[model samples]
Each structure stands twice: as structure tokens, then as C-alpha cells.
Target: MSDYDFELPDARIALRPAEPRDAARLLTSYADGRLEDRIVRDLPQILAPGDRLVVNDSRVIPARLVGERLRPAGTARVELTLLVEDEPLRWTAFAKPAKRIGEGDTLRFPVPGGVVEGRVEARTGPTVTVRFAADPLAAGAMPLPPYIAAKRAPDARDESDYQTVYADPPGSVAAPTAGLHFTDRLFSALAERGIGLSRVTLHVGAGTFLPVKTEHLNEHEMHAEWGTVSAATVAEIAATKAAGGRIVAVGTTSLRLLESAAGEGVLAPFTGDTRLFIRPGFRFHVADALLTNFHLPRSTLLMLVAAFAGLARMRAIYAHALRHDYRFYSYGDASLIFADPR
Candidate 1:
């Protein structure tokens, strides 16, 4: 635990989608926590010619499952959100109506092939274990964050909108949302302008949106996320650093992978799990800027923002956002934060 605590109002919550991908507002903050406001479409205007924008390309799988209860007659309707798929058949999930759902309880999902079945193998509070009847990846629904609840459950439309064009490796339970702003057109435009793009992969997982309940920051436990930093990306980052170009991570997921895999002293290649909980005192290894969405209050994401920008500065910026009615969360508005080495 750390002493990073703040308040965010309910009204700041964004309940809908931006009309155009880039139509949403953008807020960029300096290392010292200075803030500048701009629209997402104008991002190219503010960025320098040599800046490198790194994005996480991890694809978001459909992880939300809707099905009827099969055990104990008259079982109520249930929703199971998959947290991690161990294989084609096994998974760890967080289920609603978790009380009656226990080991061996049968669950089902709809698909053209028929019902995708599963069995609850474990249960703890709201979380549950699910052993799937088939490949969970092919049938699960996109686990959209609670704040951006959909009018209807995830469908084919989310197949494209919730994922970035560059997504490759499929592992993340949640989308690396800030990347959602970059249309192929926007990316092409930036590329044409010589604004370099880089990539890192940190599979977004269950820990990302969980609330920080403990008052003592040190007691907070971070969940491990799998990540990979390619050698080519490392070399590109080094070149960017050497040439005086800013390394702008597209999302906090990319930022975490970069910082966890590289060194404060110099960039390096890495592959492993990261439970790296970045706080105020942590020195950054990669990234000079961040493109992200506003996060839940009392969440680790907010803590990360607080660390990037000073706590007080972030507070003011967030307050301004709240006052101006900026949309918040995974499908919400975006922010461009500059990470100048302090």
C-alpha cells in the first residue's frame, strides 16, 4: 500500500459510445502533471514527427457467457464471465448468481453448433471455475466492463469495434480500449506523417478493473498478466530514445508491458508474467506518453495515472473531466498523457 486515494463522481461515467471513434475528447498530461485538453482527431497535430506510438495488439475474446441453470430444478438465469481460459475445455470465470453454482454445476451457451456446455468446478464468493464442453474461445462473449454496460449482450458488431485492427495474440479478457480510437485511417494518417508506431503485448486480465479495497497500498495484491516484448520492438524503442523521439504507449496495458519488460536504465527484450504494480515512486523503462481512458475511482488504473501524473495534478484533471462531462471507462473517451522522464 500506498497513499493514493481520490474521488470520482457517478455522473463522470460514460454510458454510451462516441459518435465517431476520434470525436471523443482527449486530455494529455505532462510528467509533472500539467494538463492540456484536445480532441482525439487532432492528436496528429500535437504529436511530433518522430514520436513512436506503441500499442498493445492483444485481441479481446468473447468471455461473457449467458445461459440457463441446469442443476437443481428451476435454477435462475445466470451469467458467467470467463477470466482465463486454461485450454479449449477448462477456464476460470466469475459468475453472477454464484451462490447456488458450485463444482459440477452445469452451464450452457448458445452458438450455431448448439449449446456450449460447462461445469462449475470451483466457487469462491463471486468467482467460479468452469470446465467447458468445447473451445471456450470460439463461443464466449466479450467481457465488456461493468461501467459501459451494453443495452444488449455482446454480438457480432463487438467482434470488430471492441478489438483493435492490429490485434493478433488472443488472450486478454478485456480490451486494450484506448487503441479503439485508432481507425486504420487514423493509423495510416499518422504513418504518413512519420509518426512511428511500436507494439507490446500484455494480455488484459481480471485484475485490471478490480477495486482497491485496502487502505494500505502495500497490502494490495496485483494479479499476474502474461506479456511479451519482442527484440525488434526493443531495438526500435532504443532507436527512438537515441534519436530523441517520444515513446507513446497506446494504452496502460502497453505501458505496463513496456515498463515491466524493459529497464529504467535501458530497453531490453523480455517474456513472462508481470505482477508489476506501478506506483508513484516507480521509474519508467519505456514510454514517454500514454493514450488511455479515464478509470474507475479507487482502481489500480487510477493509481497508475496518479503515478504518471502527480496525484494532485491528476485530481485536478479528473475534476475538470468530471465538470466537463467526459465519458469514462473502457468504451469511453480517451486521454493522451506525455511521460517526460522526471
Candidate 2:
């Protein structure tokens, strides 16, 4: 855990995304310890023709809700960030002022037309299971990362800015930040360059924003995220590999799902929950290269990247990013890292 810790200045964090999305800076970190400063739009020139880019198509849902909890004395303001849907109109969420909420308490969230009501079904620590009278999407707001939300409120711009253009399956509480750099114009360029594109689904959970609480890496337990790699995607990746092409994962989410599905030494269609905690010394079976964002210090994401590239190399890369004034975190700059040879 100490190996992953680093000092990052607060001003380096980006509050808003780059204009046009593809204009964000990209740092190419090579296994040979070479680094190149580039932009997101340069992907066509950066990647080869036969290379396949696997992207996560998981959509960010408006999961944050501000409501009032009915109390015997009076109503108290409550906040909930929906984590996962257990059933139709039923969800597990993290409640603010968790001590104030109780089982059987009614939650009322005001929406455009009216209020969306809910009943607390269960509570465990700060998290609660609630069954709503109707879909809460109507009253919910975009759930921004805690680092960003602490600074500013989620607004109209975030609704479009926080989501990828190809987002289809609505489940994720957070955006796959690396994929946020892509746009239609960039997609056209990749397509024209003959770089094949594939999609997988990994509903990024709110756990992605949680901090590493344990002292040692092994002591930390990862939150299970629902993901799927379909048969079509598996075939595409296999064909790309057979043709001597690289599998470039657009983000860690896609990379994790691909690795989870390929645990048998060969890629197979997979659909289920995954709690894959990738730290240093982990073996790589898929994803020849990775395009991802600069993660927080001591974060699981940073550890995974360190595992993919070498730890020393990652430290050097991060130092370069900081020295060069590169933006950090979600809605920040990106890094395309080529994995160390197996």
C-alpha cells in the first residue's frame, strides 16, 4: 500500500471535462520506459490497423437522490446514492446521516412533476435497501465522484459530459473515465484507420469511489461489480489475437471484464459479478495495452496499472504527468500504457 501512495496537488484535479472530449491530453507510457505526450484524437496514429479496442458500454445512471425521511418528531433531510438495483424499482444505496434512517421509514424525493416515494427495507451500516413507489431515475441526479462532488454540485452539463456517447446499458453509478475521451469524430478516425472496436458491459459500482481502507493490499476486499463479455466480443478479440493484433482495453473496467472472462487461459463469454482486485504480481492474459485515466494515490486503480506496467515505471510515468501539468482523476487527462510482456 505504501508503494502506491503519492503526493498530488489539489489544483491538478479537473472539475470539468475538456471541450469536445477528444481534445483531452493523452500520455503514452511504453514498457521500454519511453514516454510520449499526445492528445486523445491521436489514437488513430498511435494504434495499428489490426488492433482491437474493447470499450465498456455501461451507462451512468442518475443515482444521487436528495430526499426527506419521515420521522416521528419531524422530517429530516436525507441523501442517497443508489448502488445497485436488486429488483425492479428496488435498490441498495448508501445513505447520508445513516443513523437517522431506519427500517420502515418513508423517503420522498421531489421530481419535476411530483415526488417519488420509497420505503427503507433494510439497513446495514451506511448502506440501505429501499423499495420505491416508482422508478427513482426521475428524481435522481448524476452521481459524480466524491472528489469532484465535494467541490461543486452536479449540474445540467454533467448529465451529458459525464456519460460516453456509446453508453447503452444503464446501470453504472460512475462513468468509465477513460472512455469519456472518445467522441464520434474520434470513432470515425479509428474506424477509417481500420482499428476494430468491440463493446463489453461492466456496470461500474459506487464502490469505485470508495477508498482503500486496509493497511495491506491483501487485507482490502473489492466490491463486486456486475459485468458481461458476450460471445461476439470474445470471437472478435480471439480473431484480433490470431491476426497478430493487440487487444487495447479502453478502460480498466473493460480490461477487468476481459480478464475475468478469460480466466481459463482462453477468452469465453462471461456474465456475472466480479471482484477482481488487480495488484502487482498479477498475471496478464488479455489486454495487450490499456488506455486509462490517472487514478488517486493508494487507489486500487493505481495498483492495477502498476501491476500492468511495472511499479517503478508507473511511478516514473506519474511523475512525468505531474511535472508536465497533466490533469488528474475523472474528467481529467488519460494515459495509454503498454503492458509488460508475459
Candidate 3:
């Protein structure tokens, strides 16, 4: 775990996303140990004509909420970030000031026209199961990563800035940041270059933002995220691979789902929860290349890239990114890493 740690300056954190989306910087880390700096729009030139880009199309919902716990005397303020829909109208959420909330307590969240209410079903640590009288999505705000939300509150801009242009199904609480770099223009350019695009679904949970607290990597437990790879997507990938095209995962979420579905060394249709943790020594059957954002030091995300592109290579990539003044984290620069053949 210590080997994955690196010092990052506070200034490198991007408070907001790049305008036009495709204008963000892109760092290409090749298998030959060469690094090149480019922008997101240069993807068409970087990737080969036959390569297929598999992207996560899961849309982010308004999951962060500020509600009041109706009390006998008055009301206590509580903050909750919905993690997953355990059942219909029942959600598992992480609550701030959890001590103020209890099982069976009523929580009232303000929506556009009226207030929506919920009853706490259960509590475990900071996580609580709440059954809402109405869909809570309407009463919440976009759940920004804690690293950014701690500095500033989510605004009207975040409702769009935090989501990807190709977002479809509404499930994820957090956006697949890597996909945030793509725009309609970039998609058109990729198509013109004959680079095919495919879609997967991975509803990112709040657990993605949780820091790895264990001293030993083996002891860490990964949070499960719901995802699916349709039969159509499987056939698309198979056709691309058959044509000698590379599989370029647009984000870690897409990579994880593809890898999860291909666990038997064959990609297949899948729909379920996955706690697949990609670290060093984990054999990868899919994802020839990965286009992702710079991750935090000692994070599972960092470990993942290191596994894809040798640890030594990823270290150099991060060093170069920091030295060249590239931004870091969710709203920062992107990196296109080719898998290490070794």
C-alpha cells in the first residue's frame, strides 16, 4: 500500500471542469515507455481506426440531500448521499451527523413544488436504509466527489458539468469522470476516423469516493457496484476483437464491467453487482488500452492503472503529469494508457 503513495500538491486539484469538455489535457502513456501530451479531442489521432471505445452510459442522479429529521421538540438537520436502491422506493444512503437520525425517524426533503418525506428503515454505522414516500431524486442535488464538494457546494452548473454527454439510464450517484471529456464533436471525429464506440452500464456508487483505510491491500474490501453488459455489446466487442481492433475502455467503470463479464476469458452478457477489484497481479482479459482521469495517490484507481500499465510506468506518468502542470482528480486531465505486454 505504501508503494502506491505519492505526494500531490493541493493546487493541482481542479475546482471546475474544462470548458467545452474536450479541451482538457490528455496524457498518452505508451507501452514503449514514451509519454506524449495532447488534448481530449486528439483521441481520433491517438487511437487506431479499428479500435473500439467502450464507454459507461450510466447517468448520475441527484443523490445528495439536505433534509430535516422531524423531532418532538423541533427538527434536526441531516445530510444524506443516496448510495443504492436496495428495493423499490427504498435506498441505502450515507448520512452525515448520523447520530441525529434513528430508525423509524421521519425525514423531510424539499422538492420543487412540495416536500417529500421518508422513514428510516434501518441503520448500520453511517449508512441508513430509508423508505421514501416519493422518489427522492427530485429533492436532491448532484452528488459531487467529496474532494471537490468539501471546497464548494454543488451549483446549477454541476447538474450538467458532472454528467457525461452520452449518459442514458439514471442510476449512478457519481459520474464516470473519464467519459466527461467526450462531446458530440469528439464522438463525430472518432467515427470519422473509423473508431467504433460501444456502451456499458455501471451505476457508480458513493463507495467509489471512499478511501482505502487498510494497511494491507489484501485486507481491503471493495464496494459492489451494479452494472450490465448487453448481448449486443458483447457481440460488438467480439466483432472488434475478431477484426484485430483494440478494446479501449473509456473509464474505469467500463473497464471493470467488461473485465467482470469476461472473467472466463470470454466476454458475455452480464447484469449484476460486481465487487471486482483490479490491482497488481490481477490478470486482465479485456481492455487493451484505458482512457481515464488521474486518480488519487494510494487509491484503488491508482493501483488499477498501475496494473494495466506497469507500476514503474504509471509512476513516471504521474511524475510527468505533476511536473507539466496538468490538473488532477475528477475534473482534471485524462490519460490514455496502453496495456503493458509484459
Candidate 4:
């Protein structure tokens, strides 16, 4: 995993996205190690007419909550970022000051009508399962990536800024950042050029931000996230392939879900939890091209991109991005990588 590491300047991290979204710079990398610089709005020029863009349309919910934990001694400030929904009202969350929280302890969050309470039901290391007294969506804050959150706090604007223009199925705690660069105008432009657009849903989990702790990549445990690919979309993918159209996944989530649904070398309708993890040397079954944002150093996301774009080439690409001052991480610029045919 250390082989994937690269030096990134702190100044390259983007605190906010490009104002028009589509104005974000795009870096294109090809199978033969060729590179081009473009902008997000130039997708129509970058992609062929018959190519299809498979995007994740999972909506981001306000999953971060600031509350006070009621303990025997007194009340302590606790911040919770909801992860997977284990039950109707129960969510697995990462609690700040996890050591201070205990099973059965109640947390109170002040909201519009009344205070929403959550009682801790169980613990697995840093994660705790909390059953909410009311719907968390009503008062939860937007769960921003910690890298961004550490620099500044989430605000009213993030409720809109953090989500993609096409997001509809409200479930994910995190935004599929690659889709963030798209705008209504860009969508119209792509459609006008005959670039087909398809949607999949992957309720991105907060666990996506967790760092890999194992020395060997294979030893890392993948967190399960729910996703769905409709029968109609599967047919579209097949039709695209039949016509020699490229399957361009908009983000890692879409790529993972598409690969997960591809059993026996073909895509089928699917709706379930997927714990798929892509690393270098993994054979890709669906995506021919990928549009993604710059990822963290030595992170699984980077590994996945390396797997798609090739390791040495990805290193060169990242070095070029850094040299050009392209933004890094969730609010960053974009990259278009064509998979190696080999």
C-alpha cells in the first residue's frame, strides 16, 4: 500500500468547489499513458457519442449530529456521524470521545420541535449503535469529509454544495464526489452530443473515510454499503457494450456496484449490501473509463484508481496534478482515466 503514497501540498486541498461546478479542471489519462488537460464542461468533446456515463445518484443525508451525552457524572459534548442504518431507527455511528460513551447512555440533540434523543445500544471499538428517539434526518447536520471538516465547520450551504445536481434517493451519508462536478448545462450538453446517461444508487457509508490500518492491502476489512442497479440500467449497459460503447463509471461507488452486480461476466439487476474492494491488479468486468476526483494518499480509493489506470502511470498523473495545482479530495478537480486494454 505504501507504494501508492505520494506527497501532496496542503495548499492544494480545495475548501470549496468551483463556483459553476462545470468549471472545475479535468485531467484526462489514456490507456497508452497519454495525458490531456481539460475542464469538466468539456465532457462532450472528451467522450465519443456512443459512450455511456454510469453515475451514482445516491442522495446525501444530514448524518452528522451535535448533541450532549447524559452520563452519571454530567453532560459531555458528543459529535456523531451516522454510518449504516442497521434498523429503522438504529444507526451505527462514530462517536467523538468514544471512550466516554457507554452502552445504554442517552444522547440529546436540540432540534425544531423538541430534543431528539439516541440511546447507545452496542459498541464495536470506535463505532457505536444508537437507536434514535426520532427521525435523525429532521435535525442531523451534513456529514462533510473530515479533511474538509477539520479546516472548517459544515454550514447551511453544505446541505446543497455537498450533494450532486442529480441526487434523488436520499440515503448516503457521503456524496459521490466525482459527480459533484456535473451541472444541468453539462448534462444537457452530454445528451445533445448523444452521450447516454444511466443511474445507479449506492448509499455511500461514512466508513468510506476510514483509513486502512493493515500493512498489506488484502488484510484490510471492507465496510458493507447498500446499492441497487435496476434491470433497465443493466439492459442499457448491455446495449452499450453491444454497440461498442464505452461504460464510463462516474465514481468508485458506481464502479464497485456495477462490478458487484456483474456475476459470471455480465451485469444483472441487483439490490443488496456490497463489500467489494478494488486494488491494483484486480480485473475490471464493466467500466472502460472512470471519472473521479483526486484521492487521499495510500487510501483504498487511490488503490482502486491505480487498479484502473495502472500504478506507475497513476503516480505520474498525481505528480502532474500536484504540479499544476489541481485541487485534491472531495471538493477537488476531476480526472478522466481510460482503463488499460491489457
Candidate 5:
């Protein structure tokens, strides 16, 4: 939103995740927006041995379904991205042909693999509320982001690739992408080098890609995302702070969860929802380094990067990345960012 402009070739989009997690590429940009290219495998060499690496292990759920219009009969298939569950069978959804749908209707799926039935409960402008009677995933499909172009719907294969290796206690609709770059070897190397590790969970939501539409920036209301910080992770951060160890947030989600939990320069154990929006002039209470993917232009995630690393620097970095052909978005490559010094 800050007048940052750049062009990215569609050819640079990464269709699939990099193999051997740690084998993915990495971009390191300076506070001044200088660029450096390296392999993800070099993380151990890039970061200091004692720095704490905090990661979000929230796994993505199979939240997309293909259903059919009931009243119209033989109508085109409707694709629904289940947003948030309100009750046991009740959910808020982003339904396609959003034009043809209305309140108090039912949707049927001809999909052979997953759950096939649901009744529309309500309609609030863009969202179709549905109380699912079937386990859609069993009959439904996994929903990929709007960025990743695909021919067919989600299948059993997506059940695996759409998740991270450390994903446990599944709830997120999107993967904590930074974790995608870590395999056992990467962890082992970090451990062998005495690099510290910590865990935090932020159930990423569909709002992750929601663009910043407000100019004041402060007026942009961030959707609250549920997060949890275990005692162990809190202890790690506390000890790191006590020992003067810097906190290296594995992803923006983890960074947000940690900063949300930190109120008075000390991190407390937390388990709840947070809508802490980071923008220009907002002081970061915790986290020193961030490992994140290249985000979409004019997106909230991009604003977060701009907030963490100066806005001008981030724009320059994005421009540099675009020029250097760095992959962009969810399935793309990653960058290691340091918090900006104001």
C-alpha cells in the first residue's frame, strides 16, 4: 500500500515444495535491502550457534470441499473453502458461484472420495454458512491457496504434501510454510551446533492473505488467530532472554504469537486468540530474526515484513528478489529477515 511497485514473472512461481526440506533456496537481505542468495542448508552456518529458533508446528487441515447446487439441478459444481467451524457441523465457508447461493439451502456433492452433503444455514454477504452432515474431507478435497494453480481438486496425495513434518495437533487451514524447509537433518545440524529450539502454535487462517485495504494501516482490523505457547516454549524464551540469546522466529506466525504473548518484555505462557497487528511505528517487544517466505505484493504479510525490516528496505528487497527471479508466495522459496533498527 505504500507505493511499492514491482513485476514478477509467472514462471518464477514454485508449483511444488522443494525436496529434502533443507534443500530449498534462501534469500538473505540486509537492512539496507542488499541481497544474498544461498541454499536453505546453509542456515546452520548463517545463524549463530546459541540463537533460539522458534517455530509454529500448526498443521493444515483438509478444509476444501466440492458440492453441487441443490435447487437448480445439474448446476455447475460449487467449490467451498470452509473458513471457521462455529459448532459441530456448523461452519463459515467461502463458497463459489457465491452469486447463486442463498440462505436455507442444501449442497450435494457427486465427489466419489469424500463427504457429500451439507445444508446451507445462512448467508452473510460473501460467506455461506453450512452445517455439514458429512465429513467432507472423506468425500471432499483439500483446498490449495488461490496462488497455486491446479487442474483437479485435492486428493489423498494432498493429505501429505499440504502438511509439515512437525505438524501436530492439526487445526490450521494453511501450512506454517517456514517449517517446510526443515527435515530431520536440518534439526539435527541445529542441535549438533547447539542452536536452541522452541515451539509455538498459531492456527493460520484464510485471512493470512487478506490484503491491507486501509490507508491509515492502524485502522485495518486483523482477524484474530488462535495460538498457544506451552510452558516449555516459554521457558526456552525466558532462558534465552536471561542468557542474552537472540530469538529467531521461524515464521511470521510464530513471531506474531510470541509478541502477542509478550506484554512487559517478558513472555508469559499463553493459550488464546490474538489480533495483534504489526505496522509501521509499532515496536516489536520480542523476536530478533525471522525466517519467512516471499509474500504477495500489497498483502498483510508483506506489511508485516515491512514492519519487521524497514518498509523501504523490504520494498527494495522485494524488487531485488523479483529481479533475481526469487520464487514468490506459499509454495515459493524463503528469506531470512532480521528485525529493523529504527
Candidate 6:
């Protein structure tokens, strides 16, 4: 809400991923306010031995469902984006044509095996909670981000292209995109360079795309997301810090989870829901540097980067990115940002 805004050219949006995952462009913003252009494959040259790169392993689930709301009058087409699960069979979702739906109405979704259905239990605006008779995961399609979805329909290629190679825990509605640039070749390259890797989990929710509505950023209701930092991951972070190695978060999800686990002091093991809303003036306790993609304008993700690197510095970085016509959004280029000492 705080004037965190900008304009981006349409051509800057990347409709598809880079041919070779490692071939994507990378913008490096150093602590001294210097910017350098590099490709994703140059990580080995940018990072030194002992530097640990923390990544999110949460897999993107095909959570978008196309169904019909059946009633005595007629059937109405409905689209749902599953947001979060409160129970094994109950989930909160964003529904299109939500106004036409009422409580207790059945929604039928077709899938490969058979038809799956859910009953709406409650509704609050566009958000609805539904209890499914059968698992909806099997019937859903990859919930592509609005920006990408606006450009093209989700195809079979996206099933693999949108996910990271390390994705394991199946819960997120969207990909931890920074992880998408990685491949077996990139992993081997990082390993040969002595760069260590660690993982955490943050089931990214639908709220990631919700715009900041309040004029004051603090007044915005940050959506809570489930995440976990095991004792092992914390140990790895501590070892990296102790060894004078930089802890490089592979994406904002990893960085946010680490900071949420750290609280105000030292990094620690944690597992729970985190609604941590980072902005300017927020102090970071874990990540020494971050490897993330160019985010949407005025988005919380951009604000988080502004907080990690300085706001003025971030503006300059984005200006460069826009001027150079670097690809943007989920399938776009990435940036390696170092926190300002100040």
C-alpha cells in the first residue's frame, strides 16, 4: 500500500521458461550497490565454497479445478483454486462465480479416473470452505499464476516445467520458482564448487497473488502459510554461519521460513504456521544473501526484496531489469541479492 509501485512493459513478461533451465539471466545486486548481469549457470562463479544455499522443497499441486455447480434450475460452470487444507477432506478455496453458489451445493469435477466432487460448507466473499467426498488433488490441474495463465493455457509441458527438480512435499499451489532454474547439471556444478544445499518446506498458498489493499502496509492482513524447518536444516544453517560461509536462500519462501524460524535472535528449528509479513525496516536474521526471481510490481515479494536489499537499491535494480528487457514473473530471470550492511 505504501507507494510500492511501478510500471512494467508487457514484453518483459516471460510466457515460457528458458530452454535450458540454467540459461536464464541473473541480476546480481551486491551490498555496495553494484549490479552485474549473469546467467543462472554462473552460480558456481558467483558463490564460493562453503556457502550454503537453502531451497524450498514443497511441490506444486495441481490445485485448479473446473467443475459445475448443480441445482434444480441448471448447472453453472465454476472454477476453483484450492488455497489451503484445514483437514484431510476440508479445504479453503477461491471460487469463480462464487455468488451463484450457496452452502450445501455440490460441485462435480471430472478427472482421469472418475468424477470427484465436493460440498460447499461455507462461503465468505470469494473464499469458500468445501468438504470433498473423494480426494480433489487427483482431479485438479496445475494452478498457474494469473500472469502466466493470462498468456497461455496450462498444458502437459507445464506439469513438469512449473515444478522444481527437488520438489518433494506435495502441498503448494504454485512453484517456488527460483528452484525451477536448477537441474541435475546445476546441482553437480554447485557441488563441485563446494556449495552446500539444504531444504525447508513452505506450502505456498493462493494469497501469494492477492494485492495489498490497505494504504498502510501494516494494515494488510498477511495470509498464514504452513511451513517447517527441521532440526537438521537449522543445524546446517548454524554450521554455515559458524564456518564464515554465507547462507544463501534459493527463494523468498526459504528466506521467509528461515527468518520466521529465527524470530528476533538466533536461527532455530521450527514447524508451524507463519504469517510473517516482512517489509521495509524489518530485520533479517538468517539469510546472508538471496537468490530469487523478479517479482510483480508493488507486490509483497518486491517489498521483501526491498527490505533485504535497500529500497533505493531495489528500485535501481528493477530499473536496470526493465530497461534491459530481462524476462520477468514466474518464468522470468532471477536476481542474486546481498543484504545491505546498514
TM-score order, best first, reads 2, 4, 6, 3, 5, 1
Alpha-carbon TM-score of each model against the true structure: 0.92, 0.98, 0.97, 0.98, 0.93, 0.97
Summarize candidate 2's per-residue lDDT along 199-290 as a digit string, tens digits: 99999998887769899788898999999999999999999999999999999999999989988878899999999998888888989999
User: Model 5: residues >4 Å from true position, as ranges?
Assistant: 2-5, 30-34, 72-74, 110-115, 150-157, 340-342
As a whole number from 0 to 100, the lDDT of residue 180 in candidate 6 is: 95
Candidate 1 regions exceeding 4 Å error are 1-11, 31-34, 150-152
Q: Which ten-residue region of model 1 has the weakest summed lDDT?
A: 1-10
- For model 3, the stretches where C-alpha displacement exceeds 4 angstroms are none
Q: Write candidate 3's Cα lDDT for 1-342 as tens digits.
A: 777888888889998999989999999999999999999999999998999999999999999999899979889999999988888889999999999899989999999889989999999999999999999988999999888989999999999999999999999998999999999999999999999999999999988877688998889899899999999999999999999999999999999999999989889999999999899888998789999999987888898888888889989999999899999999999999998766
lDDT of 6 by residue, 245-297 (tens): 99999998998999999896888888999999989899898899999999987
Which residue pairs collide in model 3, if any?
A: none
Which stretches of model 6 miss by more than 4 angstroms?
none
Model 5 lDDT tens row, 1-342: 645445567778776777766788899865555678987899888888678999998978777776677785555578787777788778788887787787867787655654477888888766889887766655545567777735345556667767777888767877788778888888889888888988899999878877777776778888778999998899888788788777889888998899899867678899999998876666787788889998877777777788888877787778777777777777678999876555
Model 2 stretches with alpha carbons more than 4 Å out: none
Q: Candidate 4 residues 1-342, lDDT tens each? A: 677777787889899999899999999999988989999999999999999999999999899988899987899998888887878999898888898789999999889979999899987788899998888767788899999999999998898899999999988988999999999999999999999999999999887877788898889989899999999999999999999999999999999999999856778999999999898878889999999999988788988888888889889889889888899999999999998877
Candidate 1 at 188: error in angstroms? 1.7
Model 4 TM-score, all chains together: 0.98
Against the true structure, what is every candidate's RMSD?
Answer: 2.3, 1.0, 1.2, 1.1, 2.1, 1.2
